[model samples]
Target: MHYVCLTTSDPFLSLRQVRIYREKATGQVYAIKKLKKLEMLLRGQVEHVKAERNLLAMVDNNCIDKLYCLFKDEEYLYLITEYLPGGDMMTLLIRKDTLTEDEASFYIGETVLAIKSIHKHNYIHRYIDVILII
Candidate 1:
Protein backbone atom coordinates (compact mmCIF):
# COMPACT_ATOMS: atom_id res chain seq x y z
CA MET A 1 0.00 0.00 0.00
CA HIS A 2 1.13 3.59 -0.69
CA TYR A 3 1.19 6.12 2.12
CA VAL A 4 2.28 9.68 2.79
CA CYS A 5 2.99 11.55 6.01
CA LEU A 6 0.37 14.16 6.81
CA THR A 7 0.67 16.72 9.58
CA THR A 8 -2.08 18.43 11.54
CA SER A 9 -0.72 21.65 10.05
CA ASP A 10 -1.11 20.31 6.53
CA PRO A 11 -3.49 22.43 4.46
CA PHE A 12 -5.29 19.26 3.43
CA LEU A 13 -7.52 19.61 6.50
CA SER A 14 -8.72 22.27 8.88
CA LEU A 15 -10.75 22.42 12.08
CA ARG A 16 -13.96 23.69 10.54
CA GLN A 17 -13.62 21.96 7.20
CA VAL A 18 -15.57 18.73 7.12
CA ARG A 19 -13.71 17.74 3.95
CA ILE A 20 -10.44 18.64 2.26
CA TYR A 21 -7.72 17.02 0.14
CA ARG A 22 -5.81 17.07 -3.15
CA GLU A 23 -4.69 14.34 -5.50
CA LYS A 24 -1.16 13.14 -4.76
CA ALA A 25 0.14 13.35 -8.32
CA THR A 26 -2.26 15.13 -10.70
CA GLY A 27 -3.41 17.82 -8.26
CA GLN A 28 -6.98 16.71 -8.80
CA VAL A 29 -9.42 17.91 -6.12
CA TYR A 30 -11.07 15.49 -3.70
CA ALA A 31 -13.20 15.58 -0.57
CA ILE A 32 -12.14 14.09 2.74
CA LYS A 33 -14.79 13.05 5.24
CA LYS A 34 -13.29 13.28 8.70
CA LEU A 35 -15.01 10.91 11.06
CA LYS A 36 -13.50 12.27 14.24
CA LYS A 37 -16.52 13.61 16.09
CA LEU A 38 -19.01 10.94 15.18
CA GLU A 39 -20.26 9.38 18.40
CA MET A 40 -19.77 5.95 16.93
CA LEU A 41 -16.11 6.76 16.43
CA LEU A 42 -15.72 7.95 19.98
CA ARG A 43 -17.37 4.76 21.14
CA GLY A 44 -15.43 2.68 18.61
CA GLN A 45 -17.40 3.22 15.42
CA VAL A 46 -15.45 0.72 13.40
CA GLU A 47 -18.57 -1.03 12.17
CA HIS A 48 -20.20 2.11 10.85
CA VAL A 49 -17.22 3.26 8.85
CA LYS A 50 -16.52 -0.21 7.62
CA ALA A 51 -20.13 -0.65 6.58
CA GLU A 52 -20.10 2.69 4.76
CA ARG A 53 -16.92 1.78 2.92
CA ASN A 54 -18.24 -1.59 2.00
CA LEU A 55 -21.45 -0.13 0.67
CA LEU A 56 -19.64 2.62 -1.20
CA ALA A 57 -17.28 0.14 -2.81
CA MET A 58 -20.22 -1.81 -4.15
CA VAL A 59 -21.77 1.22 -5.78
CA ASP A 60 -20.97 1.58 -9.47
CA ASN A 61 -22.72 4.53 -11.02
CA ASN A 62 -21.99 7.97 -12.39
CA CYS A 63 -24.72 9.62 -10.36
CA ILE A 64 -23.31 8.46 -7.06
CA ASP A 65 -20.09 9.75 -5.54
CA LYS A 66 -17.21 7.33 -5.81
CA LEU A 67 -15.25 6.33 -2.74
CA TYR A 68 -11.64 6.30 -3.79
CA CYS A 69 -9.84 5.26 -0.63
CA LEU A 70 -9.75 5.33 3.15
CA PHE A 71 -7.13 6.43 5.65
CA LYS A 72 -6.75 6.72 9.36
CA ASP A 73 -4.90 8.78 11.89
CA GLU A 74 -4.55 7.87 15.58
CA GLU A 75 -7.94 9.40 16.36
CA TYR A 76 -9.85 9.78 13.12
CA LEU A 77 -10.86 8.04 9.92
CA TYR A 78 -10.64 9.74 6.54
CA LEU A 79 -12.85 8.82 3.63
CA ILE A 80 -11.58 10.05 0.29
CA THR A 81 -14.14 10.49 -2.45
CA GLU A 82 -14.72 12.13 -5.81
CA TYR A 83 -15.63 15.81 -5.67
CA LEU A 84 -18.87 16.60 -7.42
CA PRO A 85 -18.52 19.80 -9.44
CA GLY A 86 -22.26 20.32 -9.04
CA GLY A 87 -22.32 20.46 -5.23
CA ASP A 88 -25.20 19.02 -3.15
CA MET A 89 -28.81 18.98 -4.28
CA MET A 90 -30.13 20.64 -1.10
CA THR A 91 -27.99 23.68 -1.82
CA LEU A 92 -29.45 23.98 -5.26
CA LEU A 93 -33.00 23.57 -4.00
CA ILE A 94 -32.52 26.31 -1.41
CA ARG A 95 -31.43 28.67 -4.16
CA LYS A 96 -34.52 27.99 -6.28
CA ASP A 97 -38.18 27.40 -5.50
CA THR A 98 -38.78 24.72 -8.10
CA LEU A 99 -37.14 23.36 -11.20
CA THR A 100 -38.77 22.93 -14.60
CA GLU A 101 -40.86 19.79 -14.83
CA ASP A 102 -38.44 18.06 -17.17
CA GLU A 103 -35.42 19.00 -15.09
CA ALA A 104 -37.10 17.87 -11.89
CA SER A 105 -38.14 14.60 -13.43
CA PHE A 106 -34.66 13.88 -14.71
CA TYR A 107 -33.04 14.59 -11.38
CA ILE A 108 -35.62 12.60 -9.42
CA GLY A 109 -35.31 9.68 -11.83
CA GLU A 110 -31.58 9.57 -11.47
CA THR A 111 -31.77 9.79 -7.69
CA VAL A 112 -34.43 7.08 -7.48
CA LEU A 113 -32.34 4.77 -9.63
CA ALA A 114 -29.32 5.35 -7.50
CA ILE A 115 -31.28 4.70 -4.32
CA LYS A 116 -32.77 1.56 -5.80
CA SER A 117 -29.33 0.24 -6.61
CA ILE A 118 -28.16 0.88 -3.08
CA HIS A 119 -31.20 -0.82 -1.56
CA LYS A 120 -30.78 -3.75 -3.91
CA HIS A 121 -27.37 -4.20 -2.35
CA ASN A 122 -28.96 -4.09 1.13
CA TYR A 123 -27.52 -0.74 2.14
CA ILE A 124 -29.72 2.03 3.42
CA HIS A 125 -28.45 5.52 2.67
CA ARG A 126 -28.73 7.29 5.98
CA TYR A 127 -27.02 10.33 4.56
CA ILE A 128 -29.62 10.88 1.89
CA ASP A 129 -31.38 13.45 4.09
CA VAL A 130 -28.49 15.84 3.70
CA ILE A 131 -28.18 15.21 -0.05
CA LEU A 132 -31.77 15.95 -1.03
CA ILE A 133 -30.70 18.79 -3.28
CA ILE A 134 -31.75 17.13 -6.50
Candidate 2:
Protein backbone atom coordinates (compact mmCIF):
# COMPACT_ATOMS: atom_id res chain seq x y z
CA MET A 1 0.00 0.00 0.00
CA HIS A 2 1.08 3.55 -0.64
CA TYR A 3 -0.17 6.81 0.83
CA VAL A 4 -1.48 8.72 -2.17
CA CYS A 5 -2.71 11.91 -0.53
CA LEU A 6 -3.76 13.60 2.67
CA THR A 7 -7.36 14.82 3.02
CA THR A 8 -6.88 17.30 5.83
CA SER A 9 -5.53 20.84 5.63
CA ASP A 10 -3.51 20.55 8.82
CA PRO A 11 -1.38 17.44 9.27
CA PHE A 12 -0.23 18.68 12.67
CA LEU A 13 -3.66 18.00 14.10
CA SER A 14 -2.64 14.34 14.33
CA LEU A 15 -5.73 12.22 15.01
CA ARG A 16 -8.01 14.92 13.65
CA GLN A 17 -6.50 14.55 10.18
CA VAL A 18 -6.84 11.65 7.78
CA ARG A 19 -4.82 10.42 4.83
CA ILE A 20 -5.92 8.63 1.69
CA TYR A 21 -3.98 5.68 0.38
CA ARG A 22 -4.26 3.15 -2.41
CA GLU A 23 -3.53 -0.54 -2.31
CA LYS A 24 -0.60 -1.14 -4.64
CA ALA A 25 -1.93 -4.32 -6.21
CA THR A 26 -5.72 -3.85 -6.08
CA GLY A 27 -5.86 -0.09 -6.71
CA GLN A 28 -8.56 0.15 -4.07
CA VAL A 29 -8.68 3.27 -1.91
CA TYR A 30 -8.64 3.35 1.90
CA ALA A 31 -8.91 6.01 4.56
CA ILE A 32 -6.17 5.99 7.18
CA LYS A 33 -6.70 7.33 10.69
CA LYS A 34 -3.43 8.11 12.38
CA LEU A 35 -3.19 8.48 16.13
CA LYS A 36 -0.12 9.72 17.90
CA LYS A 37 1.03 7.34 20.65
CA LEU A 38 2.63 10.02 22.76
CA GLU A 39 -0.44 12.21 22.62
CA MET A 40 -2.74 9.33 23.52
CA LEU A 41 -0.62 8.36 26.48
CA LEU A 42 -0.30 11.91 27.69
CA ARG A 43 -4.03 12.51 27.40
CA GLY A 44 -4.80 9.24 29.29
CA GLN A 45 -6.69 7.86 26.34
CA VAL A 46 -4.69 4.67 25.89
CA GLU A 47 -7.51 2.39 27.00
CA HIS A 48 -10.07 4.40 25.09
CA VAL A 49 -8.07 4.06 21.90
CA LYS A 50 -7.63 0.34 22.33
CA ALA A 51 -11.30 -0.15 23.15
CA GLU A 52 -12.30 1.83 20.06
CA ARG A 53 -10.25 -0.43 17.86
CA ASN A 54 -11.37 -3.63 19.52
CA LEU A 55 -15.05 -2.74 19.52
CA LEU A 56 -14.93 -1.66 15.90
CA ALA A 57 -13.41 -4.98 14.96
CA MET A 58 -16.19 -6.83 16.80
CA VAL A 59 -18.95 -4.96 15.05
CA ASP A 60 -20.46 -6.50 11.90
CA ASN A 61 -23.43 -4.28 11.13
CA ASN A 62 -24.17 -2.20 8.04
CA CYS A 63 -25.00 0.98 9.95
CA ILE A 64 -21.79 1.06 11.93
CA ASP A 65 -18.52 2.16 10.38
CA LYS A 66 -16.23 -0.69 9.33
CA LEU A 67 -12.71 -1.15 10.50
CA TYR A 68 -10.67 -2.91 7.84
CA CYS A 69 -7.26 -3.25 9.41
CA LEU A 70 -5.03 -1.87 12.15
CA PHE A 71 -1.33 -1.48 12.62
CA LYS A 72 1.14 0.71 14.41
CA ASP A 73 4.68 1.93 14.21
CA GLU A 74 6.85 3.10 17.07
CA GLU A 75 5.17 6.50 17.20
CA TYR A 76 1.72 6.16 15.74
CA LEU A 77 -1.25 3.81 15.34
CA TYR A 78 -3.02 3.52 11.98
CA LEU A 79 -6.55 2.37 11.34
CA ILE A 80 -7.62 1.50 7.83
CA THR A 81 -11.21 1.61 6.66
CA GLU A 82 -13.29 1.88 3.50
CA TYR A 83 -13.21 5.36 1.99
CA LEU A 84 -16.55 7.15 2.40
CA PRO A 85 -16.79 10.24 0.24
CA GLY A 86 -19.90 11.93 1.56
CA GLY A 87 -19.36 14.35 4.41
CA ASP A 88 -20.29 13.46 7.99
CA MET A 89 -23.84 13.76 9.36
CA MET A 90 -23.05 16.92 11.26
CA THR A 91 -22.42 18.67 7.98
CA LEU A 92 -25.69 17.42 6.57
CA LEU A 93 -27.64 18.63 9.60
CA ILE A 94 -25.99 22.04 9.33
CA ARG A 95 -26.69 22.24 5.60
CA LYS A 96 -30.36 21.40 5.94
CA ASP A 97 -31.97 23.44 8.68
CA THR A 98 -34.64 20.84 9.34
CA LEU A 99 -35.71 17.41 8.23
CA THR A 100 -39.16 16.05 7.45
CA GLU A 101 -40.80 13.78 10.02
CA ASP A 102 -39.94 10.68 8.02
CA GLU A 103 -36.40 11.83 7.36
CA ALA A 104 -35.84 12.58 11.01
CA SER A 105 -37.25 9.24 12.05
CA PHE A 106 -35.01 7.36 9.64
CA TYR A 107 -31.87 9.00 11.03
CA ILE A 108 -33.01 8.56 14.62
CA GLY A 109 -33.71 4.89 14.04
CA GLU A 110 -30.32 4.27 12.50
CA THR A 111 -28.55 6.10 15.29
CA VAL A 112 -30.40 4.10 17.93
CA LEU A 113 -29.52 0.80 16.28
CA ALA A 114 -25.91 1.82 15.92
CA ILE A 115 -25.75 2.71 19.58
CA LYS A 116 -27.42 -0.55 20.52
CA SER A 117 -24.88 -2.52 18.57
CA ILE A 118 -22.05 -0.75 20.33
CA HIS A 119 -23.59 -1.34 23.74
CA LYS A 120 -24.26 -4.97 22.85
CA HIS A 121 -20.54 -5.46 22.71
CA ASN A 122 -20.31 -4.13 26.30
CA TYR A 123 -18.55 -0.98 25.18
CA ILE A 124 -19.69 2.56 25.64
CA HIS A 125 -18.55 4.97 22.95
CA ARG A 126 -17.18 7.96 24.85
CA TYR A 127 -18.37 10.37 22.19
CA ILE A 128 -21.75 8.81 21.47
CA ASP A 129 -23.61 11.45 23.49
CA VAL A 130 -23.15 13.69 20.46
CA ILE A 131 -24.40 12.17 17.23
CA LEU A 132 -21.99 12.70 14.37
CA ILE A 133 -24.26 10.89 11.88
CA ILE A 134 -21.49 9.48 9.78
By lDDT, the best candidate is 2
- How far off is residue 22 in model 1, in Å? 2.8
Q: Could you tell me the C-alpha RMSD of candidate 2 in Å?
A: 3.3
lDDT of 1 by residue, 2-56 (tens): 3333322222224213454555676677666666645554566567667777877
Model 2, range 21-130, lDDT digits (tens) per residue?
77777778877778888899888888988887887689866665578998899989988866655555565677987889987888888778888898899887866522
Spell out the clash pairs found in candidate 1: 89-133, 90-133
TM-scores for all predictions: 0.72, 0.80
Once model 2 is optimally superposed onto the true structure by TM-score, how far is the C-alpha of residue 107 displaced, in angstroms?
0.6
Misplaced by over 4 Å in model 1 are 1-17, 42-46, 129-134
Minimum summed lDDT over a 10-residue window in model 1 is located at 7-16
